[model samples]
Target: FGKSANKFLQKCGVKNEPPAVKIAELLVKSSREVWESVGRDTENYKFILQKLADDFNNIEENPDLITRMKAEPILLGVSEGKKYDLDSVENIYINDDVVYLEIYNELSMIPKGYSKFLYECLGCKSLSESIKEKVEVSGNTQETKESQDLQKKLDERAYLFYCDYPKNFIRRNEGWLKKLKVKGIDKIEAKYFMKAKNNYKIRPVTACILEDQEKCIFNFYITLKPDYLDISKCLVMYIYKSRKSREINYLAMMLKAPLEDLKYSNNDANQENSQCGVDKTEYDPQIDQNSTNYDSQLEDLFKSLRTMFEDCDHDYIYHCLKQQEEDKLINVENHLMEGNYPKIKIPVNPYDPPVTIKVGKTFMNVIQISQPSLGSYLNENQTIYCKNIKDYSLKFEKFLDGIEFHIPKDIDKSEIFSRHQNSLNHFAKIIKDLIEVFDCAPKFIRIFYDKSNLMAFNQDRALFFNFKIYLDLYKIEPTIDAMTYWYMVICHELAHKFVNDHNSEHEVSIS
Candidate 1:
């Protein structure tokens, strides 16, 4: 175990523990805490804890794995003064510049005020440069090198911050120009120009120039759609001029051909006729081919531009212009969950039809069932079985009559029928007790016995207990109790109704 494991176990109430027992105790305590917090039985938690324990032991033996584990921050689920599940934390990596952490899933178990903790665990400011150096010295293949190059370009081009466009604009020269300031840039000048003939709009162009120290740094031209509703479809042309050559070159052109037609037609005397006759060429075959090739190259340039600016935050420009105020701005955090436990509001009436509500950070519908009846098998013999059980033995009479259970005798030929009945009654009582402990009882408890060799399942507010496998096993094995198994299955399924997560691991832990 490393310093992180030691610190976590201490936080989880496992202080003064031997070094050999520290890791095991941490896994067990954390998992048990998580299970209890979610109002679930800790049966399934053992599997996850055992796996983590094995991994921890393996890492201790392997020097390289131990080093990697130490470098990465352990994500712990903290609730009610206890930590649970160290493996639940996603691995965060620092980029080459070390300016930000690359968090893959933002909804991961990174607690608030843990940024400093992560930095401490990482130990070094930057690991990206070392990783890159390793790859280079080891001789990366062509595909790996190409991918690295592309990623480098993307990283270099990525913007640090984005803003929305201003709301107010006065249309001049059939268009308008809006000047805005970027954080690092000294001056950014923008213009929107339109070309119209015979009351028909021909060209809608947006141009921007960025300057620093009286020298132009970037020039951009965007050709908007005729309606201009879909900003995603707009064509953008970025021009770059080299300082050494004093020559201008196109950096990229997004959605190019449509804009090219407007560009060529705008220069012609008769815009409508020239645009219509763009494909037509003079009778010299070789000259016509050469001209066609040049046009093809221009279209290729536009396509290339799309790739260059594919990940660029164009939405920022639209947002900046539309909002026009800093206070009204919205970011990715507005749409994502920022806390450990999602804020869940359970209605006063548990039996009411599930209503759509915000759970955690996201909005979702939760289905609640009140007084759910057990399946047909148990319901069919409810009156007859209750009467017979009362007459058969006074010992079983103490159990609540609210729950009805049916166990098929054919499940195990050697087991007595009365024993099966007694075990089921005991199981139902345990479930009720567990529910009372958690204070999350449903409207009703229903148990159905089936010989399909299936596991017990809880669905749509009802529990179907398989008599063939689960019931028979509980009778045969003293270690396997009906109460614990039933509680585990019920809690597991109830969590699904609450959060609706499809993840098996999460479902297992909750169960």
Candidate 2:
């Protein structure tokens, strides 16, 4: 209904009418590109394609969905050396006419208006009296019995979908094709795998039922043991139809693309937008907490820095943070010129300890960085500066070897001691085990209360070779799933110590 739709319709020369037979022509052309030539008797196939297009138009469905389904490699059967993939093995159209007709009707992704046209193409009479006369004329013949059996099978076949097809077919999986690589930031490919439990039992449920595009009935997860599936690995199962009995009777599964690819792409996008920066110095960790002088663009800079740090695109974020420092210097210069503030140069050595500076009678702690590293630095720096570690960990008896758990001074320790003691102990054990396994060398791991998500890593890792990690103590509750998830996040950050971006090197390090 927009430019993409309009352009497709224009190419088909059907802006004022249903796509009709042109849809079949497009399919035949596309099929030639992927498989051997199909639909030699194109005129004979016209009735079904025309009818399908008219049915979709009559139902007011977007023409794109039906057209896309027809063009994709959907049919599969045991035929040649390439065994199950019809889209890849050449010469699949051995009996072009029969297979062409079968393509329009015998599909799990069959267009809503297609079967009736297929019925007509089979030369069934349109009206009841005409049908009765035809049945009588062909009564009890072998051909009639065969046709009747075919009709019964068609009626009994199930049509299950497994994707939320975006408009113009964006991110739509090429049906049955094993994904060779990971792609798409908005959604994933390899549509039909279900989420599995420890036992890997599966049940199909309708997921993503868009009114006109597609429906994903993801009720099964045919995977190996749950232990084999790592959360950090981002496992996906690719399920496809195998033509064994009639056609598309048996389903086969293969594992494909990891979800870490999504995070990598997301970080790439963030770098493009914020142009990447990092703090080359440590700060007081509390300077910008209650400050209201920051504008929206500056706020975006802080947000970008946080996201990039989390994403592990360190170099790009370092440049962005450097720009932030330069802006602060310009402001400081203007203030000193107006006699509103004393001139002072904050050290940028990055190894310098935080020192107090006076501004308008306010003695605020500032990390003399390349002059600024601000609030986001503290938010993720892992040291909550809470003097309450010994008091809060009264209930956490299992002491970590290389980790110090701290509750930010702001959180009510008494409530945490009473309510979240079990949770703290549960997550603390996970951290301890992960550290032992990965040889993690962080000085302290802080559990602080944040709004939604949590992160780790000190703003300045150079100081005492001290890397710190922060966990959102109250972000997610103490559950098996939550523990598994945080374990992956923690491992991911630790992996950054070896390699930052999720590349082959990072993958190997994580592995």
Alpha-carbon TM-score of each model against the true structure: 0.21, 0.20
- Give the per-residue lDDT digits (tens) of candidate 1, residues 100-189: 111112212222222222222323222222222100011111233323332342233222100010113211111111122211112222
**For model 2, how big is the CA root-mean-square deviation?**
34.0
Off by over 4 Å in 1: 1-401, 406-419, 440-443, 476-483, 498-511
Best by lDDT: 1
Q: Who wins the TM-score comparison?
A: 1
lDDT of 2 by residue, 1-511 (tens): 3333243333334344435445534444564432333333232233334344334333235455444444454222233232333331111221211112232222122121122222222222211111110000111212233233322322222111122211221223433222222111121112221122111212222111111125433211112122112211122222211111111111111112233432334344334435322222222111111111223344345444434233222222222333344564343223223332211222132222345333331101111112111122234443322111122211222243444545444555667557666765655655554433333343434334333222443233311111122234444554444545455554444445545455688556544
What lDDT score is found at residue 96 in candidate 1?
A: 21
RMSD of 1: 25.1
Q: State how far residue 5 of model 1 sits from its true place (Å).
A: 26
